[model samples]
Target: MASTAASASPPPAGWASDPGVSAPLRHVRAIIADHLTHGPTDPTLAQRRAWRDALYDAIALPPDVVSTPVRDGAVRGLWQSSPGARHDHVLLYIHGGGYEIGSVRSWRVISAVLARRMGVRAFSVDYPLAPEAHFPAPVDNVVAAYRWLLAQGIGAHDIVFAGDSSGGGLTAAALLQLRMLGLPEPAGALLISPWLDLTNSGKSIDDPPGYDPFNPRAGLESFAHDYLAGHPATDPLASPLFGDLHGLPPLLIQVGGDEALLDDSVRFARRAGSEQVAVTMQVWPHMFHEFQAWAPDLPAASAAMDDAATFLDRALADAR
Candidate 1:
């Protein structure tokens, strides 16, 4: 999602003439820049959602993929799977809207495409959002969803957790919560441009060196304020970058080099590595936040998804 002019930062260096930049990439950047520049400064929730959905409206699911609504306990989400997807393994995806704006509908395209690529059943969670639910509610909801999956006869080892932006942060938080609750860890987790620091302390937030048209520091701070809702920003669960990550499963963190949250992934990867967790981090040059959502339209997006599939295959190979 993007911010209004009220929260937008000065545009970063444009990539129009950068070496190796593609025509499609330049066009995508222009589209995002124009959209954010012309957006309402005080958009209502409905307006924000519509804006987001329209941005990716052109991206479509494969014809063979099916999206079915399902509810188990507190978990409400869509079950998406393609023809060759394995029924037994689960890919539990949490969408990113800084814990405020995104929904199952807005994220269905990416979720469906990922399920198709990974050859697994995907359950994209519709967790409670902020300025309403706030703080630990989202984390609690995700943990409950994982438990519901287990109750449905899915093995913990056969499940892989994946999410983008704040959802990526929540993925880490839920893994920590799972550890505290004595629940088994999943095979691995994939985090895309994760906003893991509610404190907004990452150096990149203040000093970005590349082009990131979407997520600005002021916008991220506003989101943190609403999501944290008076809670301490440094609380490990709220900002999983502050958590103990020792026993979590293997992690593959893919972040855009130019996004404000780049440091969140770098710092978390450093901490996770120091804690002896198997963590792989990739930084895509000249890219912005959640760029993977662009998929086939953006070469980097497709490559990022391909890397994810490889990571998952390696993680799930033991079970196979």
Candidate 2:
């Protein structure tokens, strides 16, 4: 059965001005401002490493229940409410860092929230970043992690793949790659403001001043150039929006209306519908990418996550 929470109320006008802006929104804005101010000025390698470390240190995660290093050399993280918790259902979480930064630790809160909301354990993978690893490597790591899950006896129907931003793009790409490999599709997938078009074809991406607080056009273009190296942007694996959507599991996509990636999600939904894939797409007005990560305090962010949880529950139930 599908379940949902009431949508969170919008923040008041000029909410950003008050010293007492909601704690979650404050944190969210700080992160965004930091990215904008310091992201481009730092030496590239140092910036990448700092971003990686900050993301890892930001979230408070539950104690590790299991740690498995994949045979292919990627890090596999398992966390649950309790150490001995036996969970058949699994969430394979891929962290987003524009394809250059982000690790399992960086997204601990998001994974933890999903784990609690879905009543399942979550396994986050620390995939290799670009410039060092480049395109296909992250996808390869995600696929390898999925195979590792299967090797541990987790059925495809019991697994739900999820990611935010670049990781979301990777989740979609991984599904396409899985189909190409003749592997069974997972039960469902969730994407938050996925960066699906490295080609930067989305007109919304170039929209005027401050539309998306987090993702700027120039920043994204730079990241894409770094991540893809010399690869063609239109390659289906590199940009999943160009891939065939047939036979993939149900999908839930949440994106901010103001984000440059807005069109990516909209176009993806259109294609998925044409391909007869079950898809749910939500657009939050005036919000930014991955806003749900600031949940539990930001009413809109919390509501968005609650909706995601509800969608995931229904999809998982249907898989069963």
The prediction achieving the highest TM-score against the true structure is 1
Which window of 10 residues has the lowest lDDT sum in candidate 2? 1-10
Cα lDDT, all candidates? 0.84, 0.75
lDDT of 1 by residue, 198-262 (tens): 99899998777576655777678778888888999999999999998898899999998888889
Quote each prediction's TM-score.
0.94, 0.85
- Candidate number with greatest lDDT: 1
RMSD of each: 2.2, 7.2
Per-residue error (Å), model 1, residue 124: 0.2
For residues 104-151, what per-residue lDDT tens digits would candidate 2 score against the true structure? 766766776766677778888888887788888988888988988898
